[model samples]
Target: MSLHPMCGVFVLLSICLISFTTPCYGGNILVFPVDGSHWINMKVLVEELHARGHNITVVRSSNSWYIAEKSPLYTSFTVQIKENLEEFFGKYLKNHLKMEREGASALTFLKLTKDFISMVSEGHFLWCEAISEIFDDPNRVKSLIDAQYDLVLTDPAVSAGVVLAKYLKLPLVLNVRWIPSGEGHFAVAPSPLSYIPVPGSGLTDKMDFMQRIKNLFFHSIIVLQQKFVVGPHYNALCDKYIEGGCDVFSLLQEADIWLFRSDFVFDFPRPTMPNIVYIGGFQCKPAQPLPADLEQFVQSAGEHGVIIMTLGTLVNALPAEVAEEIASVFAKMPQKVIWRHKGERPSTLGNNTLIVDWMPQKDLLGHPQTKVFVAHGGTNGVQEAIYHGVPVLGIPLFFDQYDNLLRLQERGAGKIILLADVNSQTFEQALKEVLHQESYRQNIERLSRLHRDQPIAPMDRAVFWVEYVMRHKGAPHLCTEAYKMPWYSYYCVDVMVFLLSAAAVLLLSTLAIFRFLCCSRKRKTKDKQH
Candidate 1:
């Protein structure tokens, strides 16, 4: 009954071909990303997962559907929501722009906290409604439930993803685009208010007593708002949609992993839990050859090098006068300028300046001739600049931008100019100092080396952890016990209170005993005299 030699050879070759050509199977991953930087920041991780043979489905707005559709690597599903979050962001930015134009002082730390709370609250409700609409459609819900995704990856900035995870019974992971801030503190390890600055407070890790008090005040206020106001709103959404009462804070606390877009090299030293992974330069890639036109302009400066300026997608247009003032400063410098502008071209743009609607920012920064980056201090822009060892001239607008620039200045890798204070002269001086200072370049270059010195690239680390979670089914083992402790217990407030009360009681008992002894002795002496 033995097979012929030719038949056996044919079977062996067929098996080998199948093994070589068949795609390896990885677990299914569902991503729920909001618009703008949150969406852009997750692009690299998503692409990497797709490349590694994982099934990824991105649920985003129709406006950005093309982002997921452009690549056959993944599937994209679009939902129609009446309220556009970007429009709200645009309005908010306009208010800041107007204030800057009118020369208002930079937002105080308290004011920034209030503004941030409002922004998060508004976005939470808007996205909740949008997500509910997607789930309300019976067909979409059925399709999603049938898919039975292995894991849910999302930006915790919006809580809709939490509800979706609950609906599908999937494990959740947060792809935080910045250092763990206000709400993020609850999810990761507990960061002490005494040292860790409240997000957007613009305070560094090193703080005096007064600064610590201010940080405490702001942090407490934000926590209160999240607990009382934002948490309830998200809970209501969960109740209506998922038939379970889950709030934003609780969902964040339960997340299996928090992949923060930060590294200790760029950030001040702070304690992080095992579940918190620092993948700061996840989006950074080696520079590709510049487009022909961009190469010519960048090369035009030759020995002088080039300065690249961008305000990111959110802050596209500056005030007319402000734009002109910035342009004038570029004109004064010998370096060639590549400015990413959205509105009308600045009238004062110099011959050495090239204005484009958009540019490949990472590629430009990675270029050898890239001397300095003039940016709005967005997390993506700052990280890209740091990855490429380019010093920054940060003109902070709002949100984490102020804190990011403050950190850069502390590191001596960059300088900050308040948008309100950005006139031609100040801009020129800042640019000149960054370009001329050898310390700026040296420090950033050292940091860049440290950034890339890890055993695995940040994106690879991200993909590995994602697959780890899928394989382990939620990774509850990695979660810290800090999440189980109540806030007061975690900070040892109750322990401190008990110790203080015990000391007070002991002092009172000692004084009472002394007083009684004194009274008894006086009575005995009086009786003896009688």
Candidate 2:
């Protein structure tokens, strides 16, 4: 008996669904995320992998161990550190703000490099020690080795993760929180300093000769410092724990995959390798409804709209004088202000402003009545603003914050005011321009559309690539030939030297022959005269 047409269609649909939904065997994965914001940023990807039926293990701080415990699919290993990392960060922030108050002139490239190296070194040493203590227990080492993890995912910001990967003898994957900086250059394809601005240089791709020279100088200094100073320090720490010596620079260069938290839309154009993936807005989700109190406050502004100001968690508060100046500006503006302040309430704060300890920044930015975001130019904050179509007034504090703001300004989606230069007048004027200006809104809206126009959601793409790596056993074929070449060979220095030497010899030979002919002619003339 022949089947009905609709029945045949149903049979075909059933077959397709069965084929698509068939579950493939998942691999065991181990993740080592550094404490604080790095872990927070990576949690989403980790959770997704867990949901995909992969056996996932995470090594995190004791304070944040509960996060991993909440999920039944994840195995948690907590490390206790003697010194509080938060305390160190608090001290570092105080010093950084003090430097800003002193003047931007005092924030030279070398000083910033020194400050960063000191901070990262202290943090790295602590983290490495924590991981080493874990392996000091023979039982734990034997258990981890027996787990036979198919992949090791880590944040390259902390070299301890690389050492763990080395110890486990597993394929390494990098889940980076920012755009590829100087250290990243050695790992991936070559990015010429002439066009690709160094992380904190605050220059754009369209640099003039002088600016290019300055960028090149900073780039060279940073690379040298990482190689000569930071690399050795990390290597020593790694050697103390892992069996074979772990060179972080070599480990980074040999990484199987680099999942960056930035997209080309928000970054300058530069060369990248096949293994380098851009999953910029993976952390952003659809905004949820605001809390009743926040909704009421937002609605009270009527046609004027509301402004949200935050410097992220690390920077809980601004300098006292800068806070007062910003408060004074907000008081005169028509827009209602929501300031996430962790310090004493500013004396200059007016009725138009509401000071809170925390805020749902993405939800606020998504609100139609939310006019502008005043932020510290962090990657997460800026990407959220872009996703929600909110123009920014960036007050960059340190590190990649300056570069993030520079990109925003280049795209005409934001304006930057130096923390050292912020006063009532400057703050008021910049805020007014960004809020009242139609072009800022228009530019950001265009970018927002582009950011959301991807064929596949960023989270799904991230998951697919991660699984692809696992399924293909590290996907070694995707790596670039550049990774295999030495620095000199990759840059073609040897080829250039050979060509130059050959040309020099040819020129010398021609000159010598000309001199010999001249001498012969002169001798012939002498013979005739004789």
Candidate 3:
């Protein structure tokens, strides 16, 4: 007998209930993202796992640190002092304020104070402190461990969670937003810039005296911040949250799996660990239909097409000299340009160009009229362009931007322009080459196809690994035994390596011995003859 639709739905519900209620592969999964953006994709992933009958828990910190939001407190003298002082130098300083409110005045302050900004900006410390409190609170850690979560997934920023995971003996998968490094070239501070290749490769390059000194210097900065700043703050929060005296190197060694958000497409010749996985371009998803107004903007740009100029989330707003160079380029461009400027529209905005403080980036790139993406060469943005088969004119600002742009060029997907040289002529010419060149389009399309054809979506792959650990009771197999060994033992070359070295040494010794005996005998024979 054929079942009614309602009956089928009922049966499906029954099956789902049984699946979720019944014993599943493993325990609950906990996720910690630095903020909304860092954990955005992972949040979606955990939700998917939950729908599939796996349990999930997300521990998020408040967006800010404050005791209360009431008017009485808001107007209190102490509150105002905190706000004003914090606003002057805090992460909630003008740039972040401008980001939230899109205020012109704040943007002006942001540009002027850009160089003077310190890493200790209030918001950065506040959020980190908040997350640390949650992770290090013995009660919270006990509760998480008690929940019997088999796995912990976190970004490198949340190293406190790493310590918690270790205490709980749970497996870890690092969603590395940046390159994982100890005191080395590829590693940059907060972590060691150990991974970048220079005189040597990978960890070997780390042997350079200058590089090690730099690593130690940068590492010391992290240690000092933790000791003087994070340690005191953490101690005040809870006695159990004592700084373990862990550094970036310790954290790197602890991560069971290092999932790089960058791909070999960008970070090549990277000094990688055994567990490192390149799952970059993970945000490469299919396009959605553009909004009618936005679609119209793309269409109005004509057959010559438009150039998309973006400086990414961090540096979209720049100082006046940089801003003027961008404005000058817009004035000279023949095709329409959609520039994502966070500040006031410059006076040099050309008639053909439309300068909006923001654009739906993915939608812009997917459109037919987008020819070249002028970008800061952020890994995420670069991946987005490739995902849409859009070539780029990369003007790298700092950090890994240069490396990312260099790889894009190597892949034949775009051109790189240093920020110093981002004048009208260079910008115009680079735009022309990327837009007009057949090779760039072909290369980007090829990259897009490769990006699309990955064995699994990076998010899905990430989820599977997370859940796999949960199901297999920490998947101890997937984790490294490095922590089980001392640093000297871990670095000591194995038997095969030692044997190869020993054999070479013995061969050289024998040759020397033979030569010495021959020389001695020759000297004696010469003396007797004389």
Candidate 4:
């Protein structure tokens, strides 16, 4: 039977609609991504770019843990670097946890900071060397130059991408949350200590005097780290490779766009730059069918519901005692627990809990049976919890975990139990509160609705901005000239001083004139009297 004329018209219209809605792809993109968990999100972007028909080339360190040497998503150009920092990071996490257990004494605090600074310095040094090697290799350098990539996309946590982008003179886009110096906004936006809290400060946007003092001190430490610790390594590379030596902070600020991994829903409101695009929870989606066995476990909870716990991949597991305490609490709970734990099994393991190396985190959170998330408070985890509207009982470990959880707690969507205070009593109480409280669920669900109520999906927004940069060649217009200005000039301190000086000089001249005129008048009166 022949198709009706109207049916043919509808099919043709559908094709035109589909074509117009999607972007024409095949832009050449060069990705220099930081490995480990950073790679997870970067890979998400790579996949989307690939689907959009873009050609991508990723630079990977030979010692990469999570990033593979071979991938269908993108081809990797591996650089050999001695010493795997993952092992160093693992050891640091263990010792750091041990120190926390010992107590937060001055000595322990100093030791922890010293180790942290050393690890940070070492990681930058290795990558700086790797980028240096790439620069020295005539053939590879030529190949990169010849490729004529439209832009350089990187995670600014490591300074290599920022530097490499400068060296290549390509438009740069940062998949940024943390820069080498500090948080992304501190470099690219006008962040005031009065309101915007520095990371690691443990202060929220609404801070009192003492909290502001703490925030200032934290800001100072970040500046010191930039100046004394990570700066020299990249500065040396910059001096050698690029015409004018550039600091990591400056290079980071110069990026055409920042695909910020946070949204205002998750982050406290503060100053932001136009170039920064908030793509938080972009990796999230509707839950797929759970693996058969995992589905069975989740279903077994029945009306009680399931509690999902995962503390990220950085640490193998919490110290045995902490784990035992947590496990015992899970055992007592009516909710079935699915925990991603990878050490000696906790002695208090209960039939209600399932221990696994990994569980589908996003899937679990999206599941209706999942009640509360017990997490380490990583950005990905916290944002995912908010995305799924799952209330969180956070046991923040290190880095920005505390601050991430603090946002949730501030919003009443989550509760935090510090590692130093993670005994069975605290863990059990916190878990019970989150699991039973209707308010927590309501707040988070509201947040989820707000997150979904965007004009466009975050993933599409990210890809659009990436292609935006590619189309525009560079987005210097969107970038602030503030980075190029020194602090005194940027804050208009010179202008302030100039205005104050002019006023002071005018006042002095007027006073002098009055005194002289009064003296002359007095002399003339004396002459007349004589």
Candidate with best TM-score: 4
Residue 199, candidate 2: C-alpha displacement in angstroms:
1.1
Residue-level error in angstroms, candidate 3, position 390: 1.1
Preferred candidate (TM-score higher): 2 or 3: 2
In model 1, the runs with Cα more than 4 Å from the true position are 1-25, 63-71, 104-120, 134-138, 178-183, 241-244, 491-530
Count of clashes in candidate 1: 0
Worst 10 residues of 3 by lDDT: 73-82
Against the hidden reference, what TM-scores do the models get? Answer: 0.86, 0.89, 0.68, 0.96
Model 3: per-residue Cα lDDT over 387-425, one tens digit each:
899998887655556656777787799888765566667
* Candidate 4 structure quality by residue, lDDT tens digits, 1-530: 99999999999999999988865857999999988888889999999999999999999988789889898988888998888888788888988998877687798789888988999999999989988888999999999999989999999899798889999899999888998887989888988999999999888899999998899999999999999999999889989999967667778878999999999999999888889999998988888999999999999999999999998978778899999998999999888999999999999999999999988999999999999999999999898899899999998888899999999999999999888888999888888898888999999999899888999999999999999999989899998888888889998999999999999999999999999999999999999999
The residue pairs found clashing in candidate 4 are: none
Residue-by-residue lDDT tens digits, candidate 1, 315-342: 7889888999999889888899999888
lDDT of each: 0.82, 0.82, 0.61, 0.91
lDDT of 2 by residue, 1-530 (tens): 98999999999999999899946658888888766667767788887887788889888777652255446758886777667667656877887886787654534646765766776666666776777787788988888899988888888877677778877778888887531225364457777777888776788998899999999888887777677756776677667765666567777777788888888878878888888888888989888899999999999999999999999878878888889999999999988999999987889999999999989988999999999999999888999888999999999998788889888899999999999889999999999999989999999998899999999888888877778778777867777767567768978999999999999999999999999999999999999999
Question: Which is superior by TM-score, 2 or 4?
Answer: 4
* Model 4 whole-model lDDT (C-alpha atoms): 0.91
Report how far residue 470 has shifted in candidate 4, in Å: 0.7
Q: Candidate 2: lDDT of 398?
A: 81
